[model samples]
Target: MSDESNQTEGPIAGISDVPVTLTVSVGRARPTVGELLSLTADDIFTLDKSLDDPVDLYVGDHLVGRGVLEELDEPGSGRLGIRITEIAPIKDLV
Candidate 1:
């Protein structure tokens, strides 16, 4: 086998079949029924993460990367600003 035969593809593109754990934001807890009802006019529920805080990225039970959430102007169209911290090894042979 020649070296050229070992290197042919530029990149491998496909779907990832890995288990991941994502931490979702619950925002502020509702105080009371009256207070919750009163909160209507201009209510802003802030996420748990701060602007400077690095969001934790996990693959199954392992921590692999961190990303920031950026809001999009066109409604719910935000993207995950990912910074890959580690390259996780694919276990189970399939």
Candidate 2:
């Protein structure tokens, strides 16, 4: 690595105190409160969305990004591909 590469010509921006959230969906077939309480390790619930559909992601209730799933860490672990995504600064909402 070069020392000069670490230096920048402009003032640093966005030293933010912003908070964000991340959530993943396995197709949103979530159960109702009564049904949820009855669920156990052996139980099965089906998803409302199709497997090939684009997954929706949100920060709070706002849409933030979109992606298809790709495995990470191991076979059961995956990351979103995050296509066409943007996070509008929180101050804009205020």
Candidate 3:
């Protein structure tokens, strides 16, 4: 194989700077309409997964990967983050 033939553009070369939303799902809850409406300011809706379980990472509505939730102890602003553990199989996305 020639060098020129082997040197092709990468898949996401042009749109590399484009922004995408990534969401991490810790778990899910099912609530009835009345239950949802009855929620108060101090009320809590619990999720199914535990803290140690891996959370699903979604790009839009598509689940692209899974990760673990982590906390960042910044001096001024403490924030939450995720550490990616595994990527979904290509077939899984489709």
Error of 2 at 80 (Å): 6.4
Tens digits of per-residue lDDT, candidate 2, 14-90, equal 32334577665547776899999887898988888777666766767766556665555567555445443445554
Compare the candidates by lDDT and give the number of the best one: 3
Backbone clashes for every candidate come to 0, 0, 0
Native-referenced Cα lDDT, model 3 = 0.81
Error of 1 at 25 (Å): 8.5
Instruction: TM-score each candidate.
Output: 0.32, 0.52, 0.74
Q: Each candidate's lDDT (Cα)?
A: 0.50, 0.60, 0.81
The total number of steric clashes, by the backbone 3 Å criterion, in model 1 comes to 0
Best-performing candidate as measured by TM-score:
3
Error of 3 at 63 (Å): 0.6
CA shift of 61, model 3, Å: 1.0
lDDT (Cα, 0-100) at 65 in candidate 2: 57
